[model samples]
Target: MDGSVMQDTDLAVLLHQVQHRTASPEIVSSDCSASPPAVLPKRVAAAFASTDGDSDSGGDSLLRPKKLRKPTDSGGDSLLRPKKLRKPTYAARKEEIAALLEEHRLLQARLELLRQNVGIPTSYDHDTLEAAQRQQRAMEEALRLQQFALGNTQSLFSKHMNALEPNPLKTYIHLTTDAVERRNTLLSIRREKLHRCYQFVHERLHHIPETSPYHVEERYVNAKGDRIISRFERLLFPGVQDVKQVFNALLFYLTNMEISISETLGHVTVRDDIDAVETRVSNHRVVSSTSYGIELELNAVHCYEYYEKFEEMGGQEFAME
Candidate 1:
């Protein structure tokens, strides 16, 4: 009897400890006085009767089923349905949209150009060019001929020949067709015979008509053996200026010479120095070099023999062009 009582007491203590609520006698109510359960085991009829009926009473509440809706359906359970209309996502960045638009625009432009390329005809074809030519000929002259006029050499040389302006590196072509040019040529031929090579004719290199660029550029090394530029601002240019001027002045006078005759009726030229060199030239008429021509002409009373020394120095035959 004592072991059975002890076992029952331990069982009651174990059941009480499993529940969180206190196992005090005051909390235990008499289930016989309570109402019966809705649906439960009969062995625990008192416990079910003791349970609050509102909590686990209905059989339908225990196996409650969730409703499912098909994609085509729009009635019950539609709130959990797959959407027919696609929603716009706000996560796309601004740069992505702009890039797509730019690509689309470029594609459209390329398509237009391709369409034009297939259909459009060019106006530069031979037929179009020939038509233009025909029209131009009918409107204007049918035949075209090129004509050339020549200007006076003295005037052209003085007016147009500026060495500094063309910068020496420029290309120059002197093609003239005129009476003055012809006369200048004759004068040049005559002067060449005067042996300008020996300081008797063109003493300065620039005295030659094309000599500005034609003359060799002399490289002068200083005491320090450094190359220097040859220019008029330095002493060399001043020394050479007169020689160039004399050539010009001689050309001017010779090209316009008069065919004067003496009592003997010789073919005596009345140029300033036309017959002076070829004839019995006065000592005063000769030039030391193109460099000293101006000084010689100015002091014509005492000009020296310049050509003899040059003639001795393996000199070339004088020009009689």
Candidate 2:
């Protein structure tokens, strides 16, 4: 019986030591130096501890699966959450946009105003307007070129005519002895004829009645101190007809006189030369004439035809009245 009691006490002591080692696992690690302490998983340790009748309900709290506590707004743990992007707003650029819109409005208004002033219809689009502007520029350029060409032609023609004109003051010293006397006689005859023609024109002018169609104006004097007729006007009368008739009569008379003189001199070549010079000079004068009222001038082609007809007619007098 005593032996049985000793065995029971020994069993009780072994049971107490196992309970102490399980409660404090660090003591088992320190006391045992020969082998490494075996680690028990939290689940296994909690299961073992739960079997102990003396273990408190709260003893397994450390091993229980932890309930995750959500991070608070004030905590640094909130930094782990993904940030949500805020939508963009145009409020910051509102002033800039408004200013740009205002400027665009003003520019549109200015463009419209410019179009109106330039005579461009509002119905025209940008492309049409640009085309019109280009056309206008082209027309202006063409007109400028035309004027330039006209100016150049006038100057060149004037120089050519001046060069061709014979100087009345020049002496014919280079003429052969045989032709000199004949040439002097022809020149004297031409001078006398010209003086007689001038006297005839002067007499006609002086004889014009107060009620006559022709009204002559003496405004200046010529280089030879002779009075120059500046203008001729027709009297306002019931019977006053076309002034062209009077001009035709005078022209016919002068042309006939000139032909008569040339025939008397027996110089057909000189007459032909004089006709050509007169035609050229008259044509140039016609082109340059800016006189008002009666259009007495004829173009070069017409002047040529007029001289041909005059020659064909044998210098017949054209009746004025």
The number of the candidate with the highest lDDT is: 2
Can you write out model 2's per-residue Cα lDDT over 1-321, one digit (the tens) per residue? 999797667656654565566566465443332322246444334434444433345543443345899778767555876788765567648867999999998998888889889988663576798998999999999999999999999778545634542423222333234545534444444444444543545555765674667764535444456543445455543554644455565556444443554356443311121222332122112211122422233222112112212332366532221
Worst 10 residues of 1 by lDDT: 296-305
- The list of candidate 2 runs beyond 4 A from truth reads 1-58, 63-124, 165-321
Residue pairs clashing, model 2: none
What TM-scores do the predictions have? 0.20, 0.26
Q: Mind giving the per-residue lDDT tens digits that candidate 1 earns over 1-321?
A: 999798667655643442322233454455523554444334344443433353345432343343565555556458676769754564355667888999998997787677668875443344688998899987665333211123355445434433225323223334255646634544444433344433422344434553233433334554555554543211223454544354444444434433322223333323243223332232123222233333222212111222322354456322221
Q: Which regions of candidate 1 are displaced past 4 Å?
A: 1-90, 93-99, 108-297, 300-321
Error of 1 at 293 (Å): 26
Q: TM-score of the candidate numbered 2?
A: 0.26
